[model samples]
Target chain A: MNPLDKPYAQLALAVLAVLVLPLFLKSGILATEILIFAMVVAACNLLLGYTGLLSFGQGIFFGIGTYAAGICLTRWQIPVPVVLASAAVLGAATATLVGWLSIRRQGVYFVMLTLAFSQLFYFVAYTFSGVTGGDNGLLGVPRPSVGGTALNAPWSYYTYVAVCFVAVFAILVMVTQSTFGRTLLAIRENEGRAAAIGFPTKLFKLEAFAISGAVTAFGGALHAMLIGVAPLSNIEYHTSELILIMTIIGGSSSLFGSVLGAGFYLLLADALSTVWPRWLLLLGLVLVTVALFLQRGLWGLVERGYDLVFRRERAPETPAEEH
Target chain B: MTDIALQTRGLGVKYGNFHALAEVDLQIRRNSVHSIIGPNGACKTTLFHALTGRVRASSGRIELDGRDITDTSDDDRVRLGIARSFQVTSLFPNLALRENLRLAAQGRTPWQALAPWRRAEANAEALAIADEVIERLALAPVSNRLAGELSHGQQRRLEVGMAMAARPRVILLDEPTSGMGIDDIEAMKQLIRDLGRDHTVLFIEHNMGIVMNISDMVTVMRLGRKLVEGPPAQVRDDPEVQRAYLGNMITGDIA
Candidate 1:
C-alpha cells in the first residue's frame, strides 16, 4: 500500500502546506485565499470524488455563506462563531433541497439539474438586490476579533484562518474514513447494487450533499472575511466553475489533491496574470493538458514521484481510498 | 410464523402489451432450496425482480412471512429481510471483497452506515459478518483483493456472498451459476445446499444437473408461465415439463 494513502499522511501534508506557504509567498492575502479555496475544493471532492456527484451548485452554498457573513457581520454585528454556524446551516438546508430534487434523476439529467439550480441561485441573488447589495455586494465586512482586537493585519487573519483550516481539514479527513464515507464509495461504484444491499441510496446522496455544502459554505464565510467583501461573483457560475476546475486539477482521488489543485491554480494565476492580462487563455491550455496527460491531476504526479523515488512497483489502479 | 418464507399471487409484469410475466404464483417454503429452471425469455429473472421489488408488479400481492409487502421499495424489501443477487455479476468493483461484503452486512443497519464521525473499521459486527461470509464463500485467501480484480468464478461467489452478508430471511439468486466450469459449479451447488439448511434459497438456474441433485423443489417456467413445479423427481417425470423442453436443446440435460 502507498504510505501516502493513510489519512495521517494526508493530514500531515495539509499541515505542511499551511505552514510552508507563508515562507515562500509575500502576500498573506494570497496564501489565505489558497487555504480557503483548498477547503472549498475538498468539500466539492466529497461529492465528486467519493459520492460520484458532480455538483455545479456548490457556489450557491458558498455564496449563501458569504452573504450570511456579510449581512450578519456588517448590520447585526453577530459573533463570528454564530455567523459561521448560520452559514453552515443555511448551506446544508439549500443543499438538502437541491439534492432532494436533483437526485430523482440520474446520470446526465442529474448533472443538468445541478447546473440549472446553479443558474437559478445566481439569478435569485442577482434579483434580490437589497439583500445581496446588487452588484456592489455587502462591503466593509470586518475580520473577527481576537483578544479584544480586530485582526487588521493580513498575516494575523491568516493565522486565524489557518487554525480553522486545520480543524476543517481534520474533520473532513475523519469523515472520509467513516462508515458514511465508505457507503458513499459504495454508492459511487454501484448505486444499484448499493440499493440492493439495502441502502436508501437517495438519502445517502442527500446527506453527502448536505455535508459538502456545509463545508463549502464554511469556507465561503472564511473567504468573505479574507476579502472584506461578500462579492456578487462568489455566487456566480464562474465561481462554481473555478471550484470544480481546482477539484479536478488537484485530482479528486485525495483530499490533499484539493489543496494542490487550489494552490496550483492560484499560484499559476498569480505568476502569469501580471505577465499577461489574458492569463485565463493560458489556464485553458493548462486544463486541456491536465485532461490529456494527468487525468488524476497534480496529486497523481506526486504519487508517481513517490513511486519512482521509493523504487516501488506501481499499485493496481483503484479509486481514491483515502481522504 | 408460516411455512412460506416468500409468496407471490397472480404476479404479472407488462411492458405496454407484452407480458414479461403473467399470473404467476409462487410459495417458497422456509429453509428449502427452490430452483426455477427455464429456457431464455421465460421471464425467470423478471419473477426474481418482482419478488425483490426491482421491477414493479402490474398485478400481484407479495407477502413476506404472511405480511403484505407489495408496495415496499426495493431497499425496504431488503430491510424486511429479503436480499437478492443479480443475473449478471454486480458488485462494488473498486472495493475490496471484504468491503463489498461489509457494505452488505452494514446495510442491515443504515443508521450506523451513515455515522460519519466514527471509523467504518470500528464496526466490529459488520467486519465479523464480512469475515464469516468470506470464510463461507472460500474467499478468505483473497478477501483483501478488489472485487474487480477477482476471477469470474470468484466474483460469482462474491455476488452470492454479498446477499448472504445481508443476513436476510429470504435470499434470491438470479442465475447464480451462469458461467462456471465443473469444479466451480460443484462448489456452488454445495454452497446452495448448505445455505438451504438455514435460509430460504430461491435460485434461477440453467444447469439441470445442479437443479436435479440439490433442489428440494423444482419450478419450471415456459413463456412467462409456470409449466410444472414439484419435488425434483416429480418435476423431472412430468410430461408437460418434458414437452416444454422438447424443442429446446436443454431438453437433453433434463432427460
Candidate 2:
C-alpha cells in the first residue's frame, strides 16, 4: 500500500504536533510560529524530496498568500475565510504558471527558472507600492472569526492552524505516497526513463510544484493573520532558501521530518535572536555547518540508524542463503 | 504472412555532420523476435530511441499497428500497446518489487496519478500484481525486497517484467543480455524465450550465440545503415555478415 494509506494517523500527528508542542514552548506565540514553520518545511519536502525538484520560489507564493489575506480584510473588507481561500487560490494559480514554465527545463535550469521567477515576484511587489504597500506592507489584517466569535486567543488561533495543518499534511502525505507520487519518484530517479515510459513528466512535476506552492501559501497566510501584516522581506529568495535548508537539513524522508526540521530551525533562530541579536548570521552559520557535515540531514541519519537496527534483527532469521 | 509491426521509410537522423542513422529503411514483423546486431556506433540504441519516442527522428514517419506514430510521445506509445525496457535497470529503488510492477501495469493515467489517494485498494492490487509477476519470474522471495538490492540478473528480469506489465502489443529490449556472465546469459535467454508467448519482441544482443538461438529474424547494421535482414539461418550464411564481423574479428581482438 502507499505509505499514506493512514491519513488519520498523519492528521493525528499534525494535531498532536500543534497541541503538544505548547508544553515545551515558553510562549504561545513561539508555539504558533513553530507549528506554522513546520508546515512550510513539509510543503518544501513535497517538491524537493518526493518530486525531486528543488524549487526556490516557495516564499513568493507564501508571501503572496500573506499579502492576499492582508489586503482582503483591510482594504476590500473581505471575510477572513474568504480572504484565506482567495489567497490560497492565488498562490496555487501563480505557482501553476511558474511551474508550467519552469518544469520544462531540467537540472540547473529548473533551479534557475524558479529562482528567477521568485525574484520577479519580489520586484513586482517592490514596484507596486499602491496595493502591496511596497516595503511598508498592509496593516490591520482581520482575524479569522466564526459567527462573530473572534479566534484571537493564541490557543484559539493555534487550534485553527492546527486543524488546517492536519488537513494539508494529510493531503500532502497522500500526494507523496500515491500513484501520482510514484510517478514523481520515477521522475526523480531518472527523468529520461520516466518520459520513455510515456509519462507527461513535466506536467506531473508542475502539478506537484503548484500544490507545494499552495501549501506554503496557506502557512504564510495563516502566519500573516496571526501576526497582522505580510512584509516583502518575508517572501524573498532568502526565505525560500531557509525553507529549503530546513526541509533538507531536517530530513525529506517523511512529513514527520519536515515538522522536526521547522521546529528545530525556528528554536535555534529564536535562541540566537535573544543572545547575539544578529540572527541571520547565526542561521547562516548553522545552515552551512549542517550542509557541510550532514549531506543526508538529521532524519536521514535517523533512518540510517533504523535500517541498521532492522537489518541486524533480520539477519539471523533468514531461513537459508536468500537469493 | 506476418504483417509489419513497425516500419520506417527514408529515416534519417543526424547530429551535426555525423549521421547517427542515415536514411535507413526496414520492416519488422508482428510476433517475431527481431534482433538488431552490429559493431559499436551502429546506431542500435538511437534507432530504438526513435522508435520508442526517446529521440526525434529528423526525417521519416513511424507506424504502429499500421497507424502513423511519428509524433507520439513514449507514454502515448505505451498507451497504444507499445512498451520498452532500458539497457540499464530503472525503477523505484526504495519501493518493494511489487510496487514497481504495479506502476508498470497501471501504466500512466489520470487515475493512476490520483493513486496515492486510493491507498488501500490500489496498494493491495499493486501488491497482488507484484506477487503474480514475482511468482511468474520465480522471484517470490524478493517480493518485499528493495529493487536496488536485487541481483543484476534479478534486476534484468524485473526490468523485463516491468515492460511485460505494460501489456504492450510489442516489446523492445535494448541489449537485454549485455553484461551477463555465461550462466546468466542462458537464464536471460530462457526468460526472453518464456516472454515470447504474449508479444512481439525486438532486441539487440552482442553475443552471437544467444542471438542465433533466440532470434527468429536478424537485422544486421554497419556504419549507420541496414546491412542486411533475413532469417537467422540465411543471415548467418550471408557473405556480407561474415565479411563485416570477420573483418572486425581479425582486425579487432573480438574475433
Candidate 3:
C-alpha cells in the first residue's frame, strides 16, 4: 500500500509505536531524551519542510525555554504547569522579534540573518552570568509534584514527559492538516502565485515562525525538567546544527520522521561514544550517504522498502531537494 | 458606450536611467476583450506590472472603475477584484491541480486560520469554485496530477484556471497563449470569449490571428510608449502602427 495515500493509518501506527517504546527500552531516560528532541525536530519540520525556510537559530528559543523553566522553579517556586506555559510564551515572543526582522530578506541572506541573531543571543546568555549562571549553568531545578507526591522515580517522570510529547504531537498534526497549513504549503511551492491570489504571505510566514519557536521552547522546558540542569551548551550553535541534522535525517516535511530521526541520531551517538572517541566521523559519513542517495531521509528509505515489498509500480519521489 | 473598467493616466516606470514604460495613457472598457500588442522590448509586460502593483510607477495613476488604486498593494489589489497570471506560468508546481485551484480560490479569507476546524460553508464554497474551474478547463482527467508534471499546454491552461478561480472582476493575463499548439490556442480563445461575457479581459498577446479575431479593442506599444489605440480593424490599417512594426511579422497582415 502507498503510505502517503493512507495518512490516518500511518498516524495510528506512529502513535502505537510511541506508546509501546518505553516498555522495550532499557533506559527510560534515554527514551525521554529522544522524545524531547523529537518535539524540537517536529517544530523544525513545520518551518523548514512545509514553509521552505531554513532557520539556524532554533536553539535560541530552545535555550530561552530552558532558562525560563529553571529560573521559575529555582527563584519563584512556581508550579510546573505555570512554568511550562510561561516558557512557551517567552519562546513565541522571542520568535516574533527575530522573525519580524529577519524575514525581510530571502534565501542565503535570510539564513545569515538568523545565524547572526542566534550568535548575538548566545553571547548575551554567556555574558549575563549572574542571571543565567554563565559557564556553570543553572543547577538544582526541582521535579514537578502532583497534589502532594513528587514524581521523583524515573518511570513516573518518563510517563509525564511522554504525555507532554503526545499532546504537542497531536497539536502539530492538527495544524498541518488545516487550511492555514495548506496556505503555508502554497507559499512553500510558490510565493509569487500565493500573493497574486491574495494571500498576505509575509504575515503567514511570521506566524508560522512564532508557532515553531513556541513548540520547540516547550520541548526545551520538558528537557530541563528531565535533567534538573540547564547547561550553556544547550544554547550554543552546535545544538542548533545538531537539531537541523536530526530533522533532515528523519525527513523534512513528515512529523513521524522527526521522532525517527531524533531516536536514530541520539541512540547512535550514545551507543558509539562508548567505543569510539571520534564517533561524529562515522555519523558524518552516514549523513553524506543519506543526503546523496536518499533525498527524503530515513523515512523515504522506509517508504521505498514498503513499495518494494507490496507493490510493482513505485510512487514518484517527492521533490524535497528544491528547498 | 460601456463604462471604463480600468484606466491609467500618465503611467510611466523607469529603472535608474532607463525608461521601461513612459507616459502611457490607456483605458479598457467593461465586458470587453482588450489585447496589448507590441514587438519584443516594447514594455508591454512592464505596463502590465505597473497596473498590477508588482512594480512601482515613477509617474502614473491607475484607476479601477473610477477609483485611484495605484497605491494599493499587490495582494490588496487581488482582493479588490483584480487577478493576474504570469508569463512564465507561475503556479504551485508540486501541488495537485485541484489543490492549486483551491488555494487561489481561498486566498482572501485568512480569518479561517484562527481555528483548526474550518467552517463547512467556506470550504464548500472554495471546493465548488475549484471544481467548476476544473471542469471548465477540462482538467478533470488529471486533477490529481501534480502541476509540474503536466505538459506545457496543460500547464498553461491550469495557469489561466488559477486566475479565474479567484473570481476577479478584471484579469491581467501576461501572454496566456505564449507557447501552445493550434488546438490549445483555439480552446484558449473560446475560454477568453466566454470570460469576456461578465469580466474584463486585458491580455498581452503576440499572435496576430488571435488578436485580430478576438479583441474588441487593441493597443500597440513601441519604445515604451503607445503607438496606436483603436478597434482591431482600425489598428491593423494605421500608418503609424505599420511604421513601428516595420520588418516585424506583427505588421505583415496590416496591408
Best by TM-score: 1
Which runs of model 3 end up more than 4 angstroms from their true locations?
A4-7, A313-323, B113-122, B246-248, B251-255
Ranking by DockQ: 1, 3, 2
In terms of lDDT, the best-performing candidate is: 1
| Candidate 2 lDDT tens digits, A1-323 | 23322456556666777778878776777788888888888988888888888899888988888888877778777877677778778888988998998988888998999999989999999899898888898877767886789888887787787778777787887877667877777778777766666677777887787788788888889888888787877778888988888898787767777887888888888888889878888788777877898766776666667667655565544532345
Among all windows of 10 consecutive residues in model 2 chain B, the one with the lowest summed lDDT is B246-255
Query: How would you encode candidate 2's per-residue C-alpha lDDT over B1-255 as one tens digit per residue?
Result: 339888888777878878899777878788778889888889988898888887888888888878989888777888887888888777778776776777777663434664447553465654566567778777777777778888887788888788777778889998887666778787788877766777888897777776777788888888788888888778777787888563543121211
Candidate 3 structure, TM-score to reference: 0.95
Quote model 3's iRMS.
Answer: 5.9
Q: Give candidate 2's error at residue A128 in angstroms.
A: 0.8
Q: In candidate 1, residue A29 scores what lDDT? A: 98
TM-scores for the candidates: 0.97, 0.92, 0.95
| DockQ metric for all predictions | 0.62, 0.50, 0.51
The TM-score that candidate 2 achieves is 0.92
Give the Å error, residue A197, model 2.
2.2
Regarding DockQ, does 1 or 3 come out ahead?
Answer: 1
RMSD of each: 3.1, 3.3, 3.5
